[model samples]
Target: MKWMQRARVGSTLTLALMVLFLTGCPKRPEVVETVPRAIAPQGEVGMPAPPPAPKGATSGEKSPTEVAAQSPEAKPTPEVGAVPEAKIAEAEARPEIAAEVKALGLALKDIYFDFDQATIREDSKKLLSENIEWLRKNPTVKVTIEGHSDERGSSEYNLALGDRRSRATRDYLIAAGVEANRISSISFGKERPFVLGHDDSAWQWNRRAHFAVSAK
Candidate 1:
């Protein structure tokens, strides 16, 4: 009976010890369903959120720097020597005036007359011939023959004489082959004296017919 009682006590003690050990034992690691620690958005980890962009900064408001950057007028300008498109077009539109100036001589001064007369003298025949040739060459040219007289007669008489001189020159030019339509005559008479004095040399200079050429 004592031995059976001892055995029962030993069994009870062992059973209790085994139960306590089993309850206190550590468990194998497992995937826990714990909530994960909060993480910041990308490109940031530990820093605080940037202060809300100063009021209207993010609301379509443009800064001075942004406005300047958007302006096309602020772009770098090209140099002056760069090709100018409008000037090139203008230069091409108007023909040069120098070409017209070059076509006419500085002066034509060979037309002469006889002493004290409006006659187309024998000596001036070659001159008239050359001038007629010029007129034929340039059919578009119109000419005016200005007749003058020496201060030898009354103003009225000199005027008539000047007219005769101019008429004689006109008829001669027409007969020599210049178009009559292109030639007109004007008599200045003694009103316009080439030489102002009352001398032989002055009279000789004044008695003359001048030709002035112009474009039609």
Candidate 2:
């Protein structure tokens, strides 16, 4: 009977030891990898979005820098060298009579007459011949023969003498091949003396026929 009881007690101890061993050790926690979720910032509804950055220029389109560089630069006006239109118009409108007169006055010598006579002096014939040659060469030119006298005569007498002198000069020019229409005559008489003096030298200058040229 003592042996049977001891055996039963040993079996009971073994069962108790097995139950303690199973409950004492716990399972390791599972190593799970949790992924984080992204959260967006909150804003007011109905608000407009910001504008996008400007795009780069295409091959055919010009950039702001290129457009500015291609712009035309200001240039200064050039000075004109040609004759004025107004002057040319005026010259064409009026015959160049004054210019021709000035030219002939400068080129030819005056023709002188004898004291108290309408006849041209022998010495003045050569000068007259030269003037005739010039008139013949320039057929388009016209002339005005102005006769002057010494202050020794009366106004009426001097004026009559001057007319005769101018007429004689016109006749000589006409005979020397100058056209009659091209020659005009005028008398200044003693009213316009070349030199204001009472001497032969001064009288010689005053008693003269002057020539003025004009474009026909």
Candidate 3:
């Protein structure tokens, strides 16, 4: 019986040591799972997202359309009842042109011709001399000589005669020191008559050389 009691005490001590070793080993460090902390995006991390850049604006500046709308020069208004400069200049030039036409009519005269004749008459020489003197005084004035014939001849014949008459007048003016370049001659034949009649009285007036102002 003493041996058996000693065996039992040894077994009890061994069981106590095993129980303490199993319960006291710090519980295998508890296998805790830790999640990685979240980080913000690159440029927008802490900056409050820049207040959302107004509806149509860009980079915190007003949009081009909006800026233009607010500008003073966006829609300019012209003055009421104001004339354009071109219109004003045209209005001022009209009177000057009328004066030029009036002066031309007052300065130049016409000379008459005889039946089937291109040579200048004795009576017309005095008037032609006066015309030559006047032309010499106004060197800058350019004139055209218009020859007209009576309606007695054919259109072709009258036209030829009118051209000869005009050429005769032009030659006379050139001989009296007028520039050939300044005098242009044209023939009307019977197309344009000064006096409208088939009689000699009207025909005399119709056959003439008329001087007209070309330029100054």
Compare the candidates by lDDT and give the number of the best one: 3
Instruction: Report the CA-based lDDT of candidate 2 relative to the real structure.
Output: 0.80
Best by TM-score: 3
- Assess the local accuracy of residue 76 in candidate 3 as a C-alpha lDDT between 0 and 100: 34
lDDT of 3 at 153: 84
- Candidate 1: deviation at residue 61, Å? 53
Which 10 consecutive positions of candidate 2 have the poorest summed lDDT? 74-83
| Model 1 lDDT at residue 64 | 73
Q: Give the per-residue lDDT digits (tens) of candidate 3, residues 73-154.
A: 7653356566766567678876566679668756777888999889898888888898888888888888889999999989
lDDT of each: 0.76, 0.80, 0.85
Q: How many backbone clashes does candidate 2 have?
A: 0
Off by over 4 Å in 3: 1-95
Q: Number of clashes in model 1?
A: 0
Query: Can you tell me which runs of candidate 1 are displaced by over 4 Å?
Result: 1-107
TM-score of each: 0.50, 0.54, 0.57
How would you encode candidate 1's per-residue C-alpha lDDT over 1-216 as one tens digit per residue?
999999999999999999999998989789879888985454477667655556657677887788888988865335735556655665885324434533542244445566667777787777778777777887887778888888888899888888888889889989887789988998888899887898887788788887776444
- Residue 191, model 1, lDDT: 92
